[model samples]
Target: MYDDRERDTGTGRLITGLTWTLLLFALWLWGRGLTGVPHGTDGPATGDLFALTPAQAARLPRPAEPLGSALPQRVDIPQLGVQAPVVSRGLDARGAVDPPPFDQPGVVGWYGAGTAPGAKGAALLVGHVDTVTRPAVFYKLSTLKPGNTVRVVRSDGRVAQFTIDDVSVLPRAGFDARQAYGPRRAGRAELRLITCGGTFDRASSSYTANVVVSAYLTGTTR
Candidate 1:
């Protein structure tokens, strides 16, 4: 997160309580500058980052039904070689999505107030791209391409599998609440893996954009 006030601090900053709806989390972008995006203020030019053309939308698969009541315990992205524990988290006092502490950047945090991973709604899982010293769990999340698979091990001993539809790198200034956090289609189970991305500004200690990877339920294993 970029903050002119925290420009001197090497650690990234986080947006406090935002008035946005269920589509809640937004991490500060990274870059090598000292610009700051004030909390709740209108963002700079987003350059249509969230727009999906006909070609991009056509690549997404629409599932007929959702999964069962099992809770996700872990998320595995074989292509990225990412396997990490899932912890339920809520909003901070400021109403912003409360991410896991900086010391545990490898852990993924699920917005427990929303739909579960295998359920018939959009499930949101978020993590840090890096910490003060090194890269974090989702450092390579933006590298995932379409048709790649993500498996979520559930409490009921089932694995909920999702196929990648698309990935977007949205600038923090013009972040779209619906595109960033909404379900892809009605009555389908989807997942959005979010993290900070873009140019890292060593001067401000923030990134320039957020990487949102969109996926939908395709299969499950018992």
Candidate 2:
């Protein structure tokens, strides 16, 4: 007779592990898809979808506003060897930032629903560390340290440089989203680099925590 109890237990474990592996793999593939997009791009392409929740869709910043003019065009961090194009898109229902094209994976964009770049507030730039297939831009972002520099190239050809003053990892659950994306004091411009880090959980399809790099503007072409 077959030992049904033992057989079921083994099958359950296998299914659990396979589920996590597949979840992790799917996340990786999504990251790689961004790299497949063509480089030196200037506008949205066909099949390039940008979907947002009703709230996000309604909250899109108006270009006519002064704060809207502060939106960034590109982000460059020589210290970390990063120079990615910037985009502007609203957030999803989950509050997570939208993903970029796979071919133009060098792109990073402003979380439109959050703070605007170059504003007297926390400017957030989110990127993928690695898809299931390969590492993505900002993959080495955690390597940045205090005093390192991050530059932002504006649409008007001006450039703003920021100095890294701190880097910290916050638990996924403990992430203070509002504070991280809130307004800043006068004369202060902050930047935050976000990515997944810590332990990886296949079942949950996420990392244990997020790696965040905080910086402040020091110089600019203004």
Candidate 3:
């Protein structure tokens, strides 16, 4: 018999072990599906897709110039009422970018080896959607829409403000890491907030898809 507990554990592990090497490889094979990441047993089903509608795209603020490199201290998403401390994390032996510990569900993990938030390249931030018994830091990530704001407080005492421009619930079958993680424009300071999305499959014990929220630096303040 399939147990819900197993499903929860599987989802947690699959997301925690998201590989960075394989994901970055998608940059060259932009049109090809991603590999190495675990997939659910269910058929192809992309979860709720939140993108920039024509009107929203027309209203998005201009991208701000990339800031000098600085460590991130916290991330704030006012729309979702999320204000969480950010911690630096590195890849594990298997090349997977380690996420925050399951016990630290309120914390966010930044890929330390990648571009810092507000820098020229796309910065990656990952968090758990939910722990076994409760919601996690990025639980409401998919609910964010284009034009919403994301504020990242940095060690340099500047608040880097980003504007959400795209949100996608990419299914596992053809997961495209390039689209999910790469910067949308050259030289732009970008950010990606990732979490598990879609239904959890008992057979595979993992969520069928991932929710990736794309945002870019648009403003800043102290």
For each candidate in the order shown, give its overall lDDT on alpha carbons: 0.69, 0.56, 0.76
TM-score of each: 0.75, 0.63, 0.80
lDDT of 2 by residue, 167-188 (tens): 5555545444444434334446
Model 1 per-residue lDDT tens digits across residues 1-222 = 112322334332222122124335332211222232222212222333345678876776666367665667999999988899999887765556777777887899987766789887678888887776667788777777777899999998989999887777777665666766787677788998987766655566667677788889988887
Worst 10 residues of 1 by lDDT: 29-38
Steric overlap count per candidate: 14, 13, 0
Q: Write the per-residue lDDT of candidate 3 for residues 52-155, one digit (tens) a residue.
A: 56887988999999998899999999999999999998755454667788789899999886778998878889888777767788877887888899999999
Structural RMSD, model 3: 11.8
CA shift at 196, candidate 2, in angstroms?
Answer: 1.2
Judged by TM-score relative to the true structure, which candidate is superior, 2 or 3? 3
Query: In candidate 1, how many clashes are counted?
Result: 14
TM-score-superior candidate, 1 or 3: 3
Candidate 2: give its CA RMSD in angstroms. Answer: 18.6
lDDT of 2 at 50: 32
* Global Cα RMSD, each model: 11.3, 18.6, 11.8
Query: TM-score of predicted model 2?
Result: 0.63
Best TM-score goes to which candidate? 3
Off by over 4 Å in 2: 1-68, 93-95, 101-104, 183-187
